[model samples]
Target: MTDKASNSLLAKLGNQLHKNKLVKAGEILLLFIFTYTFIKLIMPLAGDNPLLIQAVVWTANILMLIYVWIGLKLRGESWKDFGLVFGSISLRSAVKVTLLSLLVFVLAIAGFIIGSVIMANITGIPEGANMSGYDYLKGNIWMLIITLAGVYIVSSFGEEVIYRGFLINRISQIGNDSKKATIIAVILSSIIFGLIHYAWGPMGIVQTGFMGLALGISYIKLKKRLWILVLAHAYMDTILMAQLYMASN
Candidate 1:
């Protein structure tokens, strides 16, 4: 291709990866790495302590707001669009949360069974079949609660805002195919969510993949109302925390 044509192609590709849900998910994965590295770098300056973890988590949450704001600006959506965030009747939201919570609970039980079976078959030890992530939660109940409230809530809602609300909606506009866009967004976001726990070992990947799909499907089915998935996630995490707390003592 000629120089101008090549440059045009590059620009189009950039825009595609920036705007498409599947493509943009890869970009978001890069953000995860960047944020991790930045946290590591800043830890030394701030002292390697619990306060450092809190600072990094809070900074990540703030980044979520910036991500959502940028997405809204790109779509020309005003504060009015945000008002839809609060449009659901209290009863409706309650029903949605209840249903979603049940779905997540069922899926989580199935996941644990599957994980146990796989681990037992592979390792030839039934006792060692438990999930490390669950073990971690059990051992660190208070920390898990803190992490869930501080990071999980922000990350889940931030993800819904950017992936489903903004990227999927924008792609639907470009292609005039809402279903395709939603599917693309959910799958890509789930994959990125799974990858983010690469540091968490194989079990982390498995656990997060299950979680990502559960939340993603919930978002797609609920028409991206956001609050429903947020409540479902929070409820799930809080219950896990509570269970861990009770079991530990």
Candidate 2:
């Protein structure tokens, strides 16, 4: 094609991305890839300082959130588009969702326990390997507080927005909004979530993957209402922090 023709094609593609909300998805994906690589490079330099590692993680998530916010603006979308509307969901509905989420959380923990037991029997993995990530926060009161705040603010919000709201929606578009496409997106996103927690070892991967699946399913059931997922995740992490604190003491 001629130069002008090629330029026109590029313009059309850009317009398409903006029109379909894929622009934000592409930008976020690129940012995530770059940030992930950068973290891997600098982690050695940061050493085993839990605080530094936590800082790196928070920085990455915050950057992604900013990028996502910008993407939403570029698409002329609001938080409501990502199921963040509080006014539309009634108070009664909110309470019901919260209660149901707690039930789901309990069931998820049970599933994790069963899965861990089965995994141990099948793989012969020792118990302590699964507890690797918890050591950093154990008995560190200040870090524990910071971690709890981070889990609720950074982790719960950032993860739900990126993996569920953005990824599932954008990826499903690739399959032309088919049910199979959505299922694929949920599974793919959940698998990535699990793999990203590799520091927690094999059981961690299994447990996290299971949680991801549960959250993904909930996201779908709730019509992509991220607020519900955020609450659920935050509560789960709060429980974890409490357990960690008790164990350390």
Candidate 3:
């Protein structure tokens, strides 16, 4: 029985890989697994009330992944097609992409700072509310390092691959015209990205959604060379992690 089960599983894996459906299945499976891990393990370990936030986060994440996959599949792309989406196809391409990505990171940081300042002034929300946790991390370097690494993996690679790599590529196939398709993809993906953060409240939704638009537009503008955006995203999140660490301590 065990041997038969193993064979069956291997067959399924082979089919997914050969058919290039691996990304679709992987995206779904990863989201589910992470959500499960967050609620069942991370929450308890961190002393967070998983019931208050994690359940909602899981639902949003799963739905978004499903939606993106359906859209991509409908557009006739196999998961293998996503391989070329990350960076440039050549060394020159890599250099150009890296520079562009760095520029975007700097701009995003500026935008976040400006937006936070404006919001605080207009709504009387404290500028430092978001910075509180960063202070705590400053006092605990090891924990901060671990947390940064975790964010780098989860936020940069996981989120970027699923959203920019998978979702946008799929949506970019919708319209017959490339330009039209790119526009639609950017708008739709950005909106979905924002909606997923509803658990963080209105500010989170807007901030994340805006960032989505920025990333999507950058990707589209770069002709979908994914490497540039991925690096930019990782760096941006790294900065955020650093800030959070500082605030926490």
Local distance difference test, per candidate?
0.58, 0.75, 0.62
Sort the predicted structures by lDDT, highest score first.
2, 3, 1
Query: How many pairs collide in each candidate, listed in order?
Result: 0, 0, 20
Candidate of highest lDDT: 2
State in Å the error of residue 72, model 3: 8.7
Work out the TM-score per prediction. 0.63, 0.82, 0.62
Q: Write the per-residue lDDT of candidate 1 for residues 1-249, one digit (tens) a residue.
A: 899998777677666655676765454555556667776777567554544555665686567567556545444455335323554468876786678667765664465456556655766765531233344455665767676766564655555564445544444444455678667766666666666556455555556655676666765666565665555566665665567556655
Q: Locate the minimum summed-lDDT window of 10 residues in model 3.
A: 126-135
Q: Candidate 2: lDDT of 132?
A: 49
List, residue by residue over 1-249, the lDDT tens digit for candidate 2.
999998787676556666655653566478669778878877777677766777787777787778677556655678788887756767999789888777666655664676577667878974633544556777778878878888877888898897788777777877787999999988988877777777788877776777787788778877887887888788878877777776767
Off by over 4 Å in 2: 1-14, 18-29, 86-90, 114-118, 126-131
Clashing residue pairs for model 1: none
Instruction: Report the Cα lDDT for candidate 1.
Output: 0.58
Question: Among these predicted structures, which one has the highest TM-score?
Answer: 2
- Better candidate number, 2 or 3, judged by lDDT: 2
